[model samples]
Target: MIDLIALRRRLHRHPELALHLPETRETLLEAISSLGLRVETSTSSSSLAVVVPGAGPGPTVLLRADMDGLPVTEESGVGFSSSNGNMHACGHDLHMAALVGAVHELTRRREEFEGDVLAIFQPGEEGAGGAELMIAEKVLLTTGRKPLASFGVHVLSFAEAGMFYCREGAVMGATINFELKVLGRGGHAARPHTALDPISTAALIVQGIQTFVAQNSSPADPIVITVGSLRAGTAANVIPNTALLKVSLRATSSQTARDAYRKIAGLGAAIAEAYGLRMTSEVGPDLGPTVSDKEGVELVRQTVGDLYGAGRYKELTVPEMISEDFSLFLEETGGAFVLVGAAVDGTPHQLPTNHSSEARFDDSVVPEIANLLAELAIRRLNIASETNRWA
Candidate 1:
């Protein structure tokens, strides 16, 4: 059995920021090497892929865990507090520990498996699209081997520990971030009639965007448009020339995401025109939705059923509006992304949400996660072999 507490403590002490997870990467690589697995760096600092070569030729299975920490202060009160301002608010520390535990188990039982297993320790999953960067560096093609399928799991604080959740289609929402800048003539506060205030234009844009979401999106289809930040005048006696608005758009489907983006841009322009201000809207790349493969989902569900019985696993009726960069990996290899429960009794009555400073992960579920991942890899490899034998 793997010492999950030690692994989590190590990750907690060495919190790595996005694209700069050298310390965490080195730690994970060292652990993989200790397990007798050959480790390969992604040529970039964003990812590390380890391979445990099997005895025979079979389908290669890939298991992924995100390694980057969030830019939040530590408030969990654990003895292993992060020295830096960053914290593992998203339970990435638990993710790394669970994967390491799985690796340890797989290495011990390596003879039972036929094909090689790839363990992906990825960074920048918070928002920087580290998975995409890893793919660009050919992280998937480790040791010149391509994965037949991949699997990833995230710990959900809302559910009770030892339970697992997954769904067939659209498991997570697509996200698009944008910034709107409204430029106008600046003047003294007393001379409001002479100068155009961009703040007014920005306010109109925010209201218009909210109305657009209500009017355009279908009731059955979930969509969220939030203006997280707004900045305008610096001084009370001056009307600032520029106003900046930072917005995030989320939808279960790509079409919904596209529609929301179009509407937001149109509304910004219209609001600016009505307020006599010049509006410049910048849209960032879309972090597409997490669409789980049907077969892969069934495989994960069956594995969970075998471990926890059929009634214990629940299929989510609706996709979560929260975003994850792991969707990028699923998009590439056509795999499944699961949400593992991490709720614990006697702790905080209400578990803090991800990215919150007070967010605490239930370490008790680490072993369950390790078992699920190892079983998923074994099952996928066996299924592939059976299919090939029939062919």
Candidate 2:
């Protein structure tokens, strides 16, 4: 059995940010080398791939783990708390440890597996689109190996430890960030008739947005529109010339997401016009939904059945409203992303969710996660080899 706690500690001590995972990359490369695998670093700073070449030519399987810390500070009070304000509040440390454990276990049981396993340590998953960068560098093509399938695991605080949750399609919601600027003439606050207060207009716009969602969207189709930040006046006596509003929109389906965006944009424009203000709306890059392939999900389910027992796995019926950058990778290549249970009890440390400053995880399930990753890779490679033989 691998010492998962030790691995987790090492990663927690050296958390990496997007495009700055050199220390984390070095650590992962050293771990892979210890397992006697030939490791290849991407020319791009965002990724690294480790290949454990099999005795014979067979299918290649890719297992991915994102390596980037969030901007939040750690309050876990553990000895390995983040040195800088940046912390692994999203459980990327556990992900790296689990992937390393899987590599170690697969190397020990190399004879049981027939094909190569490529472990990808990708960076910039925290809204940076690092997966796209890695793929652009042709990490898959350069390996001279095409993956029959790919697998990834995410730690979940909502479920009990040792239980794995997965689904066939749309495991995560679509995310899009937007900003609205409301511009108007400025004057002294004492003379209300002299100035067109943009703050008042912005407030009305915000309220109008909520009403728009309620009136436009169907009750069954869930959509969330949150105005996270708003800025307007600098001083109580002066009406600012401009106001800015930053909002995030999320939806289960593409149509719903588009509808929400349209409604929000239209509402902002209408409210600004009614208040004698000019509005400019800007939309940010899209974070696509995590849609699992049917065949890939079935493969994961079967592999988990062999490792654990039948009926131990549960397929989530409703897709989670949470968003993940891993969805970008799934969009490029068919793959299955799973959520592994890591809940804990005591002072309710689990009360804090991901991105929360008080977020914590049950470290005991690290070994199980490692085992699950290895099994998924082995099974995918086996299926690929079988398909090739028939072809």
Candidate 3:
């Protein structure tokens, strides 16, 4: 048996960030080195891909785990709290351990299965699009194995511990990052007519966004427009020449997400025109909603039910507002993304969420996640044939 708790604590103590996760990669490599498998390291980024061959011929399956930490300081008060400024606020550390455990268990039972397993340890999942990068690097088809399907696991901080959650379509929302900059004349605070104030225009734009969502979007169609950061003048005595606003948009579908983006752009233009100021803005890359395949999701649902009774697996009634880069991988290779609950000591619905400094992940769920991932791979292999492969 793998020592999952000990390995999780070790990773939790020393968290790394983004694609340059050398320490985290090294730790994972060490944990799985003992297993008799072909392991290869990525030259472009801090990533590892392992291949485990079975006894007979079958389709190949991929299992993924992200290995990046956030910039927040540790405040969960765990015994293995990170002393470094970075922390695993989103439970990536648990993800790493669970993937490793799955590899160990699967390798031991290699003769029992009939296909190959491709386990990928990815980096920079928080916002860096690491999944797409790995896909481009041929992480999915590196061993010349025909791709059958894919599977991934994420630990949630707010749901009930040991419970699994997933849906057949739109499990998570699409996201776009936008920046709006308003330029105007700067002058002394005492002067009124001499200077066009951008701060005032920005405030109006923010308020207008709320009304736009309410008026334009339907109640059944959910859209969220949040202005998370605002920057303006350096001093209180003088008005700044330019104001910067960073906004985030989330929607349930691609068309809805595009409509929300266009709405924000229109609001910025209208606000700037009203104040006789110039506006410049840019929309960053958009992550599409993670839509799961009906067959793949049903397979996962059955596997979870077998692992931990039918009551332990929940089919989400509505999509989540947050976005994940795993959507990129699932889009390229058809699969399902399962969320394993790791609620802390408090009420499941009222606990702190992922990315919160106070959020705590239940370590006991590590093995459960491992079992689910391994079973999903085995079950998918049994259903697929070696001739039917994905490019």
Candidate 4:
């Protein structure tokens, strides 16, 4: 068996970002070189898929793990921390290692199942839409047939160790990236009345949007809007011609996200018009929220309860504000995204969350993750064979 801890730490030491993860891919390839399973590579991104054949002919089931790191610098104080200025603050190291471990587990019991186990290692999940790229590159058809169902596991840095959390529908929120620009006249700072300052217009637009969103937001229908970047002028003495504010909107559904974006555009235009300046907003790729099928979530719940006892299973009542491209997999082939808790030893409230510079994950949960995923694949394949479930 591969030393999962050493492999994960090595991956952590050489963290790579976005789609072209050459170093990360090489390490992962070395980890699986001795497994002797059928492998396939992607041309669009640094994504790969491995297939383990079962006893009888049956549909394929996919197990996925994201393979990208974040842009944040590490501050977790671990001995094996990354020094390449990029860190796996989101626990992609753990995800990759656990998936590798699960692949090993399934390989040992290949004859006990009825279908092929397709393990997908995907890169560029942070913001590059690696899932979409893989789908476009025909990575989903690696097993000679489109996957009947796909399953993925995500490790949370702040969640309790050894617990599995999931929800039925809309488990993750949608993303809308917008840039609100106000066109104004540039003039000398000394003459305030002659220049239509966009900085003032931008300030007004930000305040107006925040005020409106706050008044409209509620517990049941929450909308989150954050102005991540704002740029206006190069020098203090001269007023710039334009002011741009890069904003991100998060909501439970696509309709809500589009509605909020429209409202924000309207607010920006209104504020700019009031200031006698033109305003325009452009929206980026709107990746819809992730929704898990009812049957898939139920199967995961049963598998977790039976394997790790019922106490290890926790049902999430609400959707998270974050978003991922994994929504594409669930949409292509119905499946559930399960969360495995691997927080370091600390109070839940005190531990740092994912994407934080101080975030630390417990590598001890790698074996547990492996066991649960292996059991899920076997049982799901058996159920599909018996019932001929083509979903």
TM-score of each: 0.93, 0.90, 0.94, 0.94
Question: Rank by TM-score, descending?
Answer: 3, 4, 1, 2
RMSD to the native, candidate 2?
Answer: 2.6
Candidate 2: misplaced stretches above 4 Å?
Answer: 216-220, 232-238, 346-350, 389-391
The CA lDDT at 146 in model 1 is 74
Please give the RMSD of candidate 3 to the true structure: 2.0
* Candidate with better TM-score, 1 vs 3: 3
Candidate 2: lDDT of 361? 77
* lDDT, model 4, position 31: 87
Off by over 4 Å in 4: none
lDDT of 4 at 358: 92
lDDT of 3 by residue, 1-391 (tens): 7799899999999999888888888899889878868998887789999987777766688898999999999898888899999999999999999999999988887887787888999997877778878888878777687466788878889989999989998888898888999998899999958999999998998888888878876667899888988899999889889999998889998789888888788888888998899888898768899888898899988988887899999999988888888887788778898888999788888988998888899999999898888888887876774434432
> Against the true structure, what is every candidate's RMSD?
2.2, 2.6, 2.0, 1.9
- lDDT winner, 1 or 3: 3
Per-model lDDT: 0.83, 0.80, 0.86, 0.88
| Residue 369 displacement in candidate 1 (angstroms) | 0.7
Task: Single out the weakest 10-residue window by summed lDDT for candidate 4.
Answer: 39-48
lDDT of 2: 0.80
> lDDT by residue for model 2 over 74-134, one digit each (tens)?
8877777887788888888889999999888888777776778888888988777788788
lDDT by residue (106-149, candidate 1, tens digit) is 88878877888899888888777788888888877784667878
